[model samples]
Each structure stands twice: as C-alpha cells, then as structure tokens.
Target chain A: MASKLGIIAGGGEFPGLVIAACRADGRPFHVLGLTGHADPKIIGDAPADWIRLGEAGTGFKLLKEAGVAEIVMIGPVRRPTLKELAPDWRTTKFFARVGLKALGDDGLLRAVAKEIESEGFTVVGIDSVLADCLAVAGPYGGLVPDDQAQSDILRAWEVAKGIGALDVGQAVVVQQGIVLGVEAVEGTDSLIRRCAELKREGPGGVLVKVRKPGQDRRLDLPTIGLATLREAAAAGLRGIVVQAGGALVLGREAIGAEADRLGLFVLGREDAC
Target chain B: MASKLGIIAGGGEFPGLVIAACRADGRPFHVLGLTGHADPKIIGDAPADWIRLGEAGTGFKLLKEAGVAEIVMIGPVRRPTLKELAPDWRTTKFFARVGLKALGDDGLLRAVAKEIESEGFTVVGIDSVLADCLAVAGPYGGLVPDDQAQSDILRAWEVAKGIGALDVGQAVVVQQGIVLGVEAVEGTDSLIRRCAELKREGPGGVLVKVRKPGQDRRLDLPTIGLATLREAAAAGLRGIVVQAGGALVLGREAIGAEADRLGLFVLGREDAC
Candidate 1:
C-alpha cells in the first residue's frame, strides 16, 4: 500500500481541492491545517490537526504521530514578521540553523522542506498529485486574446520577469502600454483589486503571472483559481495569462466557464518570461 | 529682463510653488493649467488659461501669444489613454512623428520638450526655477534611521532601480526585507496609501524614490512634498528616503519641521542605486 499523505494546508480553496482529490483517488491522507489560514469548512470532517505557524514542533510531531509518510505544503500564507511568528523552541532553532539563507519566499520554503526531510519525512509537490491542474499552453475556454491584450500580456511578462528576478514579485498588470501595478507581498488578488481602481478608460489591463527566477518548483508556483477569476472580472480586467506549465490552474473547467461567460480571456502562454 | 516664463502646470502644489517662486523673483509668467489637474485655488487670480490635456495646439498658441520665452512643466499627471487624451491635430501629429520612441514617461516628456524647443521656446528644469527645492544629503529633521530601517531602505533602493531601469517606476516601499508595493501609473501617493493597508504587523516600511536609470533629469525628477509627508505618516511608514540631489523636495523647511514633529526620519541618501 502507498504511504499515507500528509497535507500542510494554508488559505484558499486549494487545500479543499487537494483533499477532494485524495478522496476521489481512494488515497488515505491526513491534514495539518494552519490556523488563521485554512478554511474551517475544508478541514471540518478531515482527519486533521490545527497549529499556529510558530508551532513547528507541534506540527511535525502531529504528522509523525498520525502515521504520515509523505508531506505536501500547499496554498498561500501571509508572511509574518519575526515578532508575529513567535517561533517556538524548535522553530527558533530551525531559523538559527538556516540563518540569512532563508530570506526570500523560496529560500524560506526550501529551508523548511529540508528540515522536514531531515525529520525523516518525504516531501512532494501538488503537481505530482494533481497533474491536470498544471496550466496547459493555448487559450483556455475557447476564447482568444485580442491583439491589444496580447501586447499588454507581453509587456506585463517583461515586468513580471524583472520583479521576479529581484525576488520582489511574480505578477504585473499592464494596459495600453502603461503598467497599472506590480504585485508584492500583498499577493495577486489584492494587486488586481487595487489596479481596478487605477484602470484606464480604454481597454482594461491584463494580469500576467509567472514563476520567479531560480524558484523552487515544489513550493509556491504562481496559482490562479475561481476566486482569482472573480476578482479579475470584477476589476474590469481584459484577460488573465499565466506561464504555461509554470503555474497552477485550480478548478480549471469552472474557471474557463466563468471567463467565457464574463467575456474575458484566460490564456496559458508558453512564450512567457 | 528675463523672458516671461510659460508654466505648463499639472496636478499638485508643485505648480503653485513654481508660480510663487516666479512671483517672489519679479519674473513675469503665464500659466497654462491642464483643466482636470491644476488646483482651482492655485490657478485663481493668476495670469492663467485653462485647457484640456489634448489641446496642445491651443496651449502652445496661448503661451506664444502671452510673450513667453522659456517653459517649465511641473507636477504629476496621470497617464491617459489616447481616447481620453482626445489629441488635437498638432498632438496627433506629434505622436505620429515620435512614434514608438515616446512610449515611456521620460521618452514622451523628452519628445514634448523637443517639440516645444523647436517652437522657439527654451525648456528649463524645475531646479532652475526653484533651486532650494532640491533635496540635500544627510538626515533631515534630526531623526536617524535605525539599523533595520536602513536595511529596508537599501533593499527598496535596489528594487527601485530594477523597476526604473525597465522604465516601469521610480518608487518602491519595503519592510522587513519584503517589498510592500511598487509605483506605476497610479503614482507614489496611491502606492504609499495602498501599501499602508498591507503593512506588516511589525516595523513599518520605508519609501524610496530615485531617478530612473537614463531618465531625462529636466523632466519628472522624483519629488516629495508636504502632501507626501502626511501620506507617509498616515501610512505609518518609518521614514522616506529619496536620492540626494537627484530628486526634488518641495517646501523643504516645512517638510523637515513636519518630519520632526511626526517622529519620522526623512533622509536624502547619496549612496543610492
């Protein structure tokens, strides 16, 4: 029998989808829901334990005690300050060991995964479990981007790459040759919502998301889902583009349907930065 | 006698400050206020004529008829779509002649200045008109940045330069090694205000503004005024840092006094990116 899967769930519908995937495949799994992040409804009936971010000791112990053999950390978690983190003894020791090496999002995540591996647990990525969720190349939902949107997409791609190389952000919004906004720690949803208020009167902006340069593919690849689609539509955005095979597309069918209904294009481009 | 100055005013108090400088120095001037931007109070009772942004032909004619010789363009103007700009015949011809070369802010500004220069007018920098407004090196208001704040300032400087080189923006906000936000077409005030909402729970961020790489210094040098100070204070930012001698600091004495009163450090750093 395959080893039981351990899911370290964070915010958004992503965690719930992963749990549903496990059930559908008859794969036994356990969840470690991060407090203040994972939805209560999603963790409701699952065999799970809840812990604060600083409670790394409790988290790892719970997973081991629950007979979890393989682990996958999923979803978005707001970056907390050192004070807010309030790291426990084990967590403090972990940071002390890593030192400044764990600075950017990818660095910190890789360090944590290494620690988990050192604790005798195997680590996996969400893509391995839900291969269909990886965005494919081409227009999604049978809608193609217009020439104007294509131009904006290309501009935003260059910007996203620039910021990503600096480890500043992974997404940008551009409209009619003007950059509407750039994502930072505020995340993509907030980025889109704010850019909506700053949109120009002409064609709406396009949101382009790509993976950060030198990023660890296993952790925190760019993601778009139903919630992101709704935000973009409400923000009067013309379209959404994610790096093909470099980002995740959650609830793909539903997202495509919503995009078509809203007269917006959802594309996964391979020619991306 | 000095040539009558042609003040092409946009939004913000910078324009009003220029008019005041001209008045104090006994230099005759005519103001051509862009309708939607210039404050009504500032343009009131001055030798001024108001016109929409697209009326370039009318604006130039008014300046020429006013016996103006030198021109200075000051203040922030939101980037408008071509439709919103509603370019007149001359403006259309100007864009056509410049073509793709006038895409970025600096590029567009240079093209416009060249056009004005060709029309028997000399273009001058705001520093030429208001020399004291240039930011100087050193800690302003007697407040010094703590080590942590200094680190964030340095980080934001690099990000600012990264975006600037791309001709994307000139300002960025950073806290605890995380980039809070980056300015784009929405401008710095909005960038600071929005980042305030996304500020981390611990130390507030620092706003860093620098000259864009290869920017035309005579046009749109990064600027901070009393309005910017209040916005930063309201946003709970620890300090504001601009490239020393590379940016404009309007109302310098008042800004120092306000920064002192608010217990925020306003420094002009020479070791900038």
Candidate 2:
C-alpha cells in the first residue's frame, strides 16, 4: 500500500512547482488549500480539501481521514488576523495554549508545527523533497558583479545580519551603501518595488537576503524566484545575494537566464563577513 | 562678545523651530543652509550663508570666519550622493582618509563631526538650546493605547533597535505584530504615508521612533511633530511612542492639542522592554 504525501498549499507558484515535482515522481498526494490564499487550479483534480486558515482541527481531521502520514507546507501566506479568520474552537484552543509566545510569526509557526506533530503527522521541509530547487551557491548568469557591487554586497550582508538577528525581516536593499529598503510584514516583492522607487541612479545596488540567526529552517527558508530577478532588474539593482545553501531559488536555470538578459547578478554568497 | 551659535540647517520645520527659539531668546546666530536641502525662506533675516551639501570645507571656513565656535546641525538632509555634491577639495581629501567607511550616512556624519571638532568647533545638540522641543515623556492625548497597541509598540521598539543597530534608520510602523513600514532612505513622513496605505482596520497600529543606540547625540535625533500626529490619525493608528528624552516633538502644545482632537495617543515610552 502506498503512503500518501499530504500538501498544505498557500499562495505563490510554489504549490504548483511542488505538485509538478510530486506528479513527475509518481507520488500520490492529498492537497489541502488554505481558503482565500491557495490557488484552486494548482490543486486540480487531486484528492483535495479546503480549510479556512485558522481551522486547525478540521484540517487535521480531514488529513487524518485521508490516510496521510507526512506533509510539506509550501508557498507564501500573509499572516492572518484573528478577527479576519474568526478561528474555530479548535484553533482558538490551540492558540490559547500557545499564548503570548505566539506573538511573533516564527513562534506561532513553531507552535503550530508542534501541535501537528503531537497529533501524529510529521512536518518535513519542502526543500528536502526538492533539493534541486535550492539556490546555486556561486555566481549565476553571464554577468559577474563588479568591484563596486562586491563592496555593496558586503555592506548589505552585514546590515542583513543585523536585520535577521531581530527576526523582523529577511531582506535589505542597498545601493552604494545606502539602504533603499528593508523588508518587514510587507514582504520581499513589495520591498523590491519600494526600492525601485527610492533608488537614485547609482553604480552599486544589490538585494541581500539571509536566513534569520537561530531560525528553524524546517519551517521557513528565505526564498527568491523569477519575480525577484525581474524586480531587481526593474529597480536598477546590480546584483542579488542570498546566504549560500540557505535559500530557495525556484527554477534556477530560468532565473539565471533572466539575470543574464538583464545584466544582473544572482550570487549565493557563502560569507561576506 | 557673546559666543555666536551657528546652525547648520537642513530641510523640514526643525530648522525653523530652532531659528524661532534663537530669535525669542535674542541669541546671536549664523545659519548655514545645506544647498538644495534647506528652505531659504526658513532662515528669514537670520545671518545665514548657503553652501553646497558636502562642501564641508566651505561650511567650516564660513563658520570660522563668522567667529562661531559652537554649532547645532538640525533637520533632515537627504544624504548627498558624491556626484550630486561634487565635493570640494577638503571633503574629497577627507573622504580619501576615511576610506570605505565613508560609505554609510552614520559613518560620514561621524567623520564630518570629527573633522569639525578637529577644527576647534564644538558641536552641540539642538535640544540643549530648546528643552521644550524634546518629546514629553508619558501620555499626551484624549485616548491611551489599549493593550494591543502597547504590544505593537514593544514589537516595533525591538525592530527599530535592529534597524538602528545597522545605522539604517530610526522609525518603524507596526500593527499587531506586523511591521507595515521600516524607515530607511525614504524618511519618517514617507514611512507614515506608506503605512497609511498598508494598514487594515485594526486595534494595534502605532509608530515607534527611537534614537539609534550609540548614535551621536550631537547629530540627528529622532523627531516627530504635529504633522506626524495628523498623518497617524489619518492612518487610523491608535498611538505613538518615542524613547523618553531621546526624540524631538516640535511645538509640544500644538502636538498635544492635535492628538487630543484626533483621539490619538502620543506616548513617550521610556523602556517598555
């Protein structure tokens, strides 16, 4: 008997990518879409169910009934507001136990993961299932960053670490050592857009994204994709740097080709410090 | 001869406020407008000179010639780009000595301050001249921050510290635990405006402005004014917090009156950590 893999899908193309991977390998799966966030088309005709974002117990019961033992949660989900979600009694009870520690997003995710584990489903990082999607740890594309960009990348690397230490964000945009934008709850795409507006014509501009120090990688890893490359080029950025082996760069070949077309850089910086 | 106080003024109302203070007390002064940043009209009849931003030599020469030994640098100056300023021989030579550290605004300011001190000029904090302009510590409104707003403030305080630790910026806007805006090159008013758009109807939005830790007090101090109060009210925020004794709240009476009228809180949280 085949053990079915379960997928908890959110927004963005990640769920689509994961589904493609699952199907290519002939893995049977159950998809649970978080209502209002997940794309219906991505779930397709797969054995699937829909659950409101805060309906923990309902989601758990459905997955259990479907005979799923392991799951991968993927894609972007804006942190839902309690009022907006109107959490059911089960989620409310779960949060009550979480209490004040659930104030931070990381804490809330950890607590949620722990709850699901206690109920007997294992939470595995989606990356383990799709290691090929991990960002390449070197210069990507035809364009190599110039000396000025290297300097900017180092400065941004230091600044990003400071940002990550607080767990407020994962990315900082810099040009000639001036920070154009810092990501927060608004997310990275918005951060890149804001940087495009704030940027002055300059010699050195780079996007630096890093994993939060002490962050649990199994839950969330800093990620970039084709959209990030397009936006960086639009923002007149010279390069993009991610902590090597710590971020996902989906469709890496396409992203590299795009970067080359735009005369931009996609570098997975191991250590600029 | 009364020791003449020199004002190195930038944009915004802070310079105007300081000018009024000097005039009210009959304090002899010389004002130097950083070209393109300061409003020429703001100096109105005050003995003032205009110098290109980053023309440090010209600025120092003028102040020395005017027999000014003490100076206060005030208001917001868009950190000048090298090509835009076309630095004079002195600033060019200075940057050469400072090397790559000249890359950041804080490093540049610190370097400039050291140079000024080396030339025998004492840089004084503007608050020393007008204590009333310093933000009042504690409550100042018709409405107090409820529990949720308080939680947001603490979260924002932590985030702002991280931003400041990198010498990036000094303000952050938050709602619940979500950071709506982080101030960087765009400045505070722009940050507030951005937040107004990002805000969803909520119980917890607040502005937390703080002095960067280990930042030089003689230079930029975190500031807010009646404009901030009106904008925050427009954004549907519940409260505001600035580190006690560390921020400027221009026209205190008017700010308090406006906050009361808008039913918003202007709290000066000393240390809620």
Candidate 3:
C-alpha cells in the first residue's frame, strides 16, 4: 500500500497540480489547506484538512491522523505580519526554537524545514515529486532571442545577481542597456506589468530571474509558468530568462506552446548568474 | 557690473526657478533652452535661444553672443537615445573624444562638462548660484520621523548605497525592514508611485536618496521639490530623506509649505550614505 503523502497548500495552481500528480501515481494524499491562502475550488473538493496559518500544532495532528509518511510544501504563501501570526502553542513553540534566525527570510524557512524534519516527516522539494517541472536549458519556444534582446537579458542577469547578493530580489527588467525595474516586495508578474508601462517605444524589455545567491533550492525555488509567458506577452516583452535547472517551469509543454504561439522567447540560462 | 549668466535649461521647473532668481537679482541672463525639453512658458517668456540636444555648436555660439561668463545647467533632462542624438558635428566630435569613458552615466556628463569648459565658458554648479535651493540638515516640516519610518530610511539608505556602487540608481524605498522598490531608469516619482501600491498594511514607507558614491556632483545632483512633496503625500509615504547640501531642493519655501500642510517630513541626512 502506498503511504499517504501530506501536502501543505498555498495560493496558485501549484497545489492543484500536486493533487493531480499524486492521483495519477496512485498515491493517496491529504492536503492541509491554508485558510484564505489556498485556492477555494481546489481545496473545496479535495480531502483537505482546513488549517489556519499559525495553527501548526493542529496541522501536525491532522497529518498524523492521515498517516502521511512524506510532506511537500508548494505554492505561493504570502508572509504574514507579526499580528497575523496569532501563534497558538505549536507555532509559538516553533518561533521560540527558531529564535533570532527567524529575522532573515531564508533563515526562518530553513528553521521551519528543520522543525518539520524533527517531527519525523520527510520534507521533500516539490520538484522531486513533479520531476518534469524543472525547466531545461535553451529556449522553450521555437523562437530565438534577437541580438538586442539577448544583450538585455545578459545585462539584466548581471544586475539581478548583484541585487540577489543583497538578498532583496530575484527578478529585474532590462531594455536596450538600462534596467527599468527591480522586483523587491513585488513579485515577478507585477514587475513584468510595471516594466510594460516603462518600456521604450522601439522594443520591449527582457524579464530575467535567477536564484538568490546561495539560496536553498528546496524551498522557494524561482518559478516561471504559462501565466508568466502570458503576462510577458501582454507586457510586450521580447522574452523571459531563468537559470536552468535552478528554477521551476510549471506546465513546461503548455508554456512552450504559449510562447511559440505568442512569438515570445523563454530561455533557460545554463549556469549560476 | 553683474557677470552675465547663461542658463542651459533642461526639463523641469528648476530652470524656471533659476530664471526667476536671476531676474530678481537684476542679473542679465540668456537661456539656451534644449528644444524638445524645458518648460515652454518659462523659456518662451525669457530672452531664450532654442537649440536641439546634440547641437552643442549652436549652444556655445549663443552663450558667447550673450556675453555670459559662467553657465548653470538646471532641470531634469531625459537621457536621449542613439537615434534622438542625431549628433550635430559638435556632439559627434564630443562623444568621439570622450570615447569609451562616455558609456557610464557620470563619465558622459563629466566629459560634457569638460567639453563645454574647453570652449572657454566656465561651467558653474547650479548650487553655487542657487545656494538657497539646497536643502539643509534637519526636517523641513517640523516633524521627526517616527521610529519605524526612521529605521526604514536607514535601511533604505544602506540598500541605495549598494545599488549606487553598481552605478544603477540613487534612491530606494523601505518599509519595515524590507525594500519596497528601487529606482533605475524610472525616476523617484515613479518609484514612489510603485511603492505606494506595494506597501503593506502599516505606516507608510520612507524614501532615501543620496549622491551615488562616485557621481559627479555638478552634473546630476539629486533633487526634490513641491511636486515631490505632493506626490509622496498622495502616495501615503510618511517622509523623505536626502543628503544635506548634496541635493538640490527646488523652490524650498514651497516644498516646506506643502510638506507642512500635508503633514509629511522632508529630512536632510547629515552623514554620507
């Protein structure tokens, strides 16, 4: 018998995809739907245990009852404010143990993954389950980048890396030779939207993404998908680039199809930025 | 006799303020307004000579004819594209001589200043004549930044300096401990506008601007004015901070008035960022 898998679902289609992948593989799984964050339709029909954020004690019990042997944390989870934490016994204890390291973004996540592991549930990266989701090197679309677009991508990559070293952001938009936008609190889609309004008249810009230098890939891996392609196309961008194998390309085939249809380029950079 | 002053008008109200200042002093002045830029009303009302950008030959001739001994370049000039340059023999020769060094923003401006000086007109810093236009140390609106806003400004100051080292931008917005937005090709007003949309629930963010580490002070000194106060207030920002005497404060009285009326703080940082 396949051991039941436990899923912690957040926003976006990622959780939904996880369910389908588990079902196709004949693996039974129970999802802990984070209230107000996970998609309503996806959590509504699934065998999900509704859990509020900051209720980790309750969440652990649900996973135990479901007899889950492994866990996957997937999708976009908006970081809550201090007041929003409203920690009960579990999350309060969780924070106490993490202590000062919780101040840094990566530090807190690392502690969370460590705390979950201490609870005896193996925390696995989503990519391990959905192997094909990792984007490959080279352009996904039939189209190739023009010289100017390629140059912009390279320029953006350099700037993005510098910002990453600061650990502030992962995406930047560059056109011709100048940077138009750098994503900080704003995510990639919004950054692309802002870039659209700022692009010069002659040609569109390039959206480039790379992992924050030395970032743990297991958590918060950079992702681009069909929606990314759609948004970039709508933004009148020439192309998109992400570090190959270091980022997730959700729905790769569909994204490639969309890219080709839109005459946009989706390039996967081969090495660390 | 008062030395004849030549005003090279760029794009913003700074040029207009200079003209008014000169008029008030009964200082004879001639304005060489860049054709596509500069406020039409202000330039039109003055003894102005119109010359397109890159037509430096005509500009030098006009200054000589006006008997101007020193010149002050003011206002916000959008950097022109290659095609827009359509370089007349003067600018074409200027770039050729500046050569590879003209690639960086500061380098190009420095070369331009040097080129103009070589033509025998002493290039004067705008601050030299408009000393009253410089923002002083301390708050203009009689309000101190609260603890949160103060911390955000300090945090933003650090990040802005890092970006400055890359010669990318000079301003950054920070709320809480996170950077909300960064300025690149997009100017301060737009960055503030973007920050307005990205700021989370809480007190608003702080805008921190400083001269880039090695930037030529005379060429593109950071600036703020009444419109800045209005827009920042409209965007729900708590305050703004800049390097004391290192940045131009156009229409200081009007900015102070608007800042006080809107309950926003305008600060001048004492230390180098």
DockQ of 2: 0.62
lDDT of 3 by residue, B140-204 (tens): 77778988787788778888887877667888988766788888877899999888988777677
Per-model DockQ: 0.65, 0.62, 0.45
Model 3 chain A lowest lDDT segment of ten = A99-108
Best by DockQ: 1
Using lDDT as the measure, the top candidate is 1
Please give the range of 10 consecutive residues that has the lowest summed lDDT in model 3 chain B.
B99-108
**Can you tell me the CAPRI class of model 3?**
acceptable
lDDT of 2 by residue, B210-233 (tens): 988888877788988888888888
Candidate 1 residue runs with Cα over 4 Å from true position: A100-105, B100-105
User: Ten consecutive residues with minimal summed lDDT in candidate 2 chain B?
Assistant: B99-108
For model 1, residues B5-73, the per-residue Cα lDDT tens digits are 999998888888898888999999999999888887977788999888888899889999999999999
TM-score for chain A in each prediction? 0.96, 0.94, 0.95
Report the C-alpha displacement of residue B262, candidate 3, in angstroms: 2.1
The clash count of every prediction, one per candidate, is 0, 0, 0
